[model samples]
Target: MNTVGVRGYSLELRTRIVALVLGGASPGEAAKHFSVHVDTVKSYLKRHHQNTLHIVAKPTGRRRTVMALHEQQLLAQLETHQDATLQEHADMLETITGLKISYKTVDRVFRRYKITHKKNTGRQRTP
Candidate 1:
């Protein structure tokens, strides 16, 4: 889901907003004090009444990854084949782990570990 500007409120903040409303403050007043939407304050009040005032856990967004399960094996393979390109590394990983993974995934893993895929070339002289 696209959540560019959307965000979840903290449990403490929600509870405070609800408390404000319960303590004779209007929903709009609570919203203004908390700098949140009036609808948010209303929702908090509703949740308080329903006794379901809790913080929602965020989605992890972790899909299946070949490298995550076989980091040691992939590291061993890389140690044995330092000159292998990204595609070659991906193919070798697939063959060893029987998990389908793309070269881009391999590149992402390398980047995450701060490992450079490109070889160092001598400095170019400016004419």
Candidate 2:
């Protein structure tokens, strides 16, 4: 989100504006005190007094997938058993935890976590 052209006014400014308004000072008087436009003062006081202003910043970024502790343990198992095939790992995880993840998903998870796939070390036979 962009916060352009907004001056760094404190919450104290809003509090002072509210105090002035409550003390029978006109909106124009409050605006003159704060050096802001009358409409701006009105808007600020309206928001501050209404108790409906949301000052909290909303959460951003992608939500993480909620994995169980057992799922994490399964991932650790995969890290130790890199020689196992994707299908083998998937089947084993499913059997152990009843979570049915696909072989493609297992491969994707490995890649996503930067876990290298097992490299072939056996000698190749010539045709």
Best-fitting candidate, measured by TM-score?
1
Worst 10 residues of 2 by lDDT: 1-10
What TM-score would every model get versus the actual structure? Answer: 0.63, 0.39
**lDDT digits (tens) for residues 15-37 of candidate 1:** 99998899999998988898888
Residue pairs in candidate 1 whose N, alpha carbon or C atoms collide under 3 angstroms:
none
lDDT of 1 at 100: 73
Residue 69 lDDT in candidate 2: 55
Tell me how far the alpha carbon of residue 78 in candidate 2 is from the true structure, in angstroms, after superposition.
2.2
**Model 1 CA RMSD to the hidden true structure, in angstroms:** 5.8
List residue ranges in candidate 1 displaced over 4 A. Answer: 1-12, 25-43, 49-51, 55-60, 119-127
lDDT of 2 by residue, 1-127 (tens): 2232444345677678777887999999987887867776687678877873335334565543326554575587776875677788888887877778787867777776776565545633222
